[model samples]
Target: MELRKSGSAVWSPASDWRRGSTVRWLLLSVGLGWISLFDSTLWSQTKEVVLPRGTDVSVMKKDILLFEKILDVKLSHIPNAMLAVVDRTKGVYLKGYGIVLTFLVNINRVVITTPFGERPVGKRQTAEEKRRRIHEIREMLIQALKDNPGSFKQLTPSDAVVIVAHFEDSNELDDAKRHKTIVLKVFKRDLDVYKTNGYEKFKQQVVIDEY
Candidate 1:
């Protein structure tokens, strides 16, 4: 008896299995998208603490006035400053991005005469001097971080920390990136991308602009 050739095998089972897997994957992707949207909305609802410019009204005005007087120049002459906060459960540590004015003081000059001795101090620094001093202070700030490891700790996932990095000029951004470990290592809560505004805008809001 002649046996008829077997008809071509039907791969229906394999095709159906693949189709089922594709459907499941699509559903999973949609579910993840919804979850991501919800998370984004929740994050937006949380309060944000802007820095430097966000200080108390009275304190901001006072600082502007003080800087103007000490610099002996218009607020426009002063470079913009940034502020960052290292948030911990106990308290927050704040640092300003501007130069350390204390180091600019003249140690050689005599400021006051006392019965016991004389107090030597320096006069207010010029804009040029302040600019130069910023680089020096940056090194010291980095060194301090290296020396004091306990001062900075890793941030928890829930922690909301803001790091404000002030650049002396636009070119400094590259330098800051080169030495990010010193300048931005403590900012573990977020990535190194900074949201910044112009010094002119900041001056308009806070500076008196008048002599």
Candidate 2:
């Protein structure tokens, strides 16, 4: 059996929150839009757009690059072709209501091999090791977002910055417990508290929906 290092779970938003939301969150569903992040005339097409006033397009580009680099470090240890795209990094804000930032990552591995194209000879990996690896990756993602909190300040207590890490699942597990993907999400109201509270604190408030 092959082993991977991504935590498995889904995020659940409150019923009232969804019903009361004014912004159209297109990226919440599986089959959603993949709008590229850039300065374009597209923003002018709609009165409601992702980038708000004072949003620096250049800084956002750097943030995307930083996200890619962070993912590379985690997957590079074992030669792997991993993809992390910011296809749907959108935001919506309401003056009195709140703001929301949605980020999606596609962690689909193309090839697994060394820089020299040689598979490393190692012993079988255990479940514990895999969980630990996944946890590290999750933390890196959260930290990266925290570091480059561009318009994240606009988010209020009701607002949130959502990050969804989707891992492509190969049908290698037992038929009784097979999954097509592994999703790990980070949902927090206050970014400042993340540093002092730690992962365990955040996990306490996490609402997970497992299949």
Candidate 3:
């Protein structure tokens, strides 16, 4: 995975999640496009929280790394990949297995027939357009996952949440399920539920199609 220096980097799933609360806050800030305002002092102030008696941090980290590798191979064509680890015993943890971007732009070449002749035109989607499209993509992916139970067959107790982000394509939802890199898919509405209703309620509503 390629790593960038200006707050946008291809973070390994293992190392990214192991940094504790401060890293979580940083990731949240990054997701919200607030990376510029991230406080470095919070790193020193952050404390590691203890897990349950049976939760093995090392094992979890190793599993996450393996999952990252699988996702990297499966979604190699996509430029951005994000993982969310949902533990039945523990809570959900979000990480980036590969390159993930705050902004997405879709550029494509299309044949446009003008008044005189037909020629290929390159079209670039604006940030707002891309954002709306991505939102729809997330919803489609979640619906696809809900419809296919076989996609999540590999998930065990150790494996929790696994998600990836990419532009909306007709074949991508099916391709991800066939690749088996993700266990559960969540959309923006689900995240709202997670924040407002709480984790248990979030899990209950995760698999339900909101479209």
Candidate 4:
């Protein structure tokens, strides 16, 4: 694979990379066009980043790590037992390729451990409770997206950012992955509003899909 800096100059690992880092540069197969080869393991590891055609390897990798750092700091809070993005970020492919990123936030205990107390969520969710939880998580994700133009630089105008809040239980696995959750997505074009406009306008510009 050929690497290029943001200046579009060729990047040499020995000259460019700092120490204590690992490279998972997207493999570019000769004569294979722009196809990405992936098995289960690669998919699991790389799902956080949704790459577009002509993606910048050096810039994208650096910016992905930056987005991850933001996610770490912004969502690094424990209420009662906890509130976090599970272990790591996860994503799914759309019908198209390299157009999405879905981050799973563990909101199981987050919904329960509240200022009032553990309000029952999951299957017992009333419409109001569901709305409240969804809105709360959406706002939190909005906060997570703030002031980071780097995060969206690698994404195309057609690509998007998706945040999923999984209402997971402490021990139960199925409920954790399947039972209750909220998914919010916005196009990177819309997300880039923060760069030109301010946070207030950008927040309103983001469309919260199903909490």
Candidate 5:
């Protein structure tokens, strides 16, 4: 009796014809298109800049001024502990980004309002807890200076001073990175101070507190 030939014996089409290759190409194209359409917008609105240890205070002041001029805003009430931007053009200040500060004089502790994202110094039992923390930090700094009047001098003559910069970029974009890219070009002179004093010394002083 004649039996049907095994299906395996039947001729098959080319491997390429069995499945569509365009599926892979289509997926790749769609992925690339999605990536191209992705928005690079910043996630946060206000950016905080705790200046690096090696920044020269004098130069930093100038940089702040220049930044203000470019942005057309006047920042007042600058403090070592915190600074909140108050736009000269507009009267009201935004609370989320503004800093509350209590300036100390003559080694006495002064309490200031604490802004969000600030680390507390001690047990933060209440809303006032944050204010006390800032006051404590200031008090500690005052005490440190009192304990060693020469502490300020411990900073090598060339050691850089720190500065904080605030930008209106609410999205807290990498404005500092972008700003540094341009500022460094114009303020190349400060770069020499770093090379001479060395960032290692500055970093050590910041950590060790040994002047």
Candidate 6:
């Protein structure tokens, strides 16, 4: 994956996900009327394309990479997160999202980082505290299961369609070793239920027929 200073560079997923890319792209298409002020009428000739909804979907798979330079650690391990992209026909645009997570421990503390639009916990936390936080996160997953089985909750925007991913840590020693466990769960959308609840609870109804 390409890495650059935050604002100077934007992330874009590789053309294909099989080779392992963590980048994603967010595009904004402008209107023809506003093009003149920027410099040129770039989009003046743009035309919208319409396709049947739910007709576009592609599967993505990738392995995680550990960035030594970024973390400043002797050793680093990366955990993989599932990636998927769905094409919506209503808009004349395409968007991408990717998720990743990692666990590390240094002399002062243990840290767990998730890129699923969820923020990592700050502050120096004891190894035990970190484990507890993971437990709580697991509970939230359980609650989501209880709320709706066979249905995916968009834990983050990066995770398109249903969500699929797993995390594992094996650190038994007190020195640089803090976690030893594995947790994984994948879920797909329950179109039937989503269509049902979308209207009542979410206040926005998904037109199944559109897809």
| Per-model CA lDDT versus the true structure | 0.35, 0.45, 0.40, 0.57, 0.31, 0.31
Indicate whether candidate 3 or candidate 6 has the larger lDDT.
Answer: 3
Query: What does candidate 3's lDDT look like per residue over 3-115, in tens digits?
Result: 54447555665556677767888888777665433544455445455544544456555544554444334333333332111111122243322111111222121334579
TM-score of 5: 0.18
Each candidate: RMSD to true structure? 19.5, 28.9, 28.2, 23.6, 22.0, 28.9
Provide the lDDT at 81 for model 4: 21
State the lDDT of candidate 2 residue by residue for 57-112, as single tens digits: 46545544555555455445432333333234444443444333334332333334
Q: Kindly list the per-residue Cα lDDT of model 5 for residues 4-54, writing each as its tens digit.
A: 446655333543444456777888999988776663223132244454355
Best by TM-score: 4
Q: lDDT per residue, candidate 6, 1-211, as tens digits? A: 6644468754545534623432322112234335555544434433344543342222211111112122222112212111100111111112343222233223222244467654433345466764665454444433333344322222232232322212223223553343233332322333324444533342122111100
Report lDDT (Cα) of residue 70, candidate 2. Answer: 51
lDDT of each residue in 38-123, candidate 4, tens digit only: 45557788887876567666776666666666665655653322343566554444433333444555544424566888765444
TM-scores for all predictions: 0.23, 0.39, 0.27, 0.49, 0.18, 0.23
Off by over 4 Å in 3: 1-120, 166-211
Number of the top-ranking candidate, with lDDT as the measure: 4
Backbone clashes (count) for model 1: 1
| Distance from true location, Cα of 121 in model 1, Å | 3.9
User: Number of clashes in every candidate structure?
Assistant: 1, 0, 2, 0, 3, 1
Off by over 4 Å in 6: 1-55, 58-124, 144-176, 179-181, 186-211
- Using TM-score as the measure, name the better of candidate 4 and candidate 6: 4
Error of 2 at 110 (Å): 14
Residue 128 of model 6 has an lDDT of 77
Better of 1 and 5 by lDDT: 1
How many times do residue backbones clash in model 3?
2
lDDT (Cα, 0-100) at 166 in candidate 2: 40
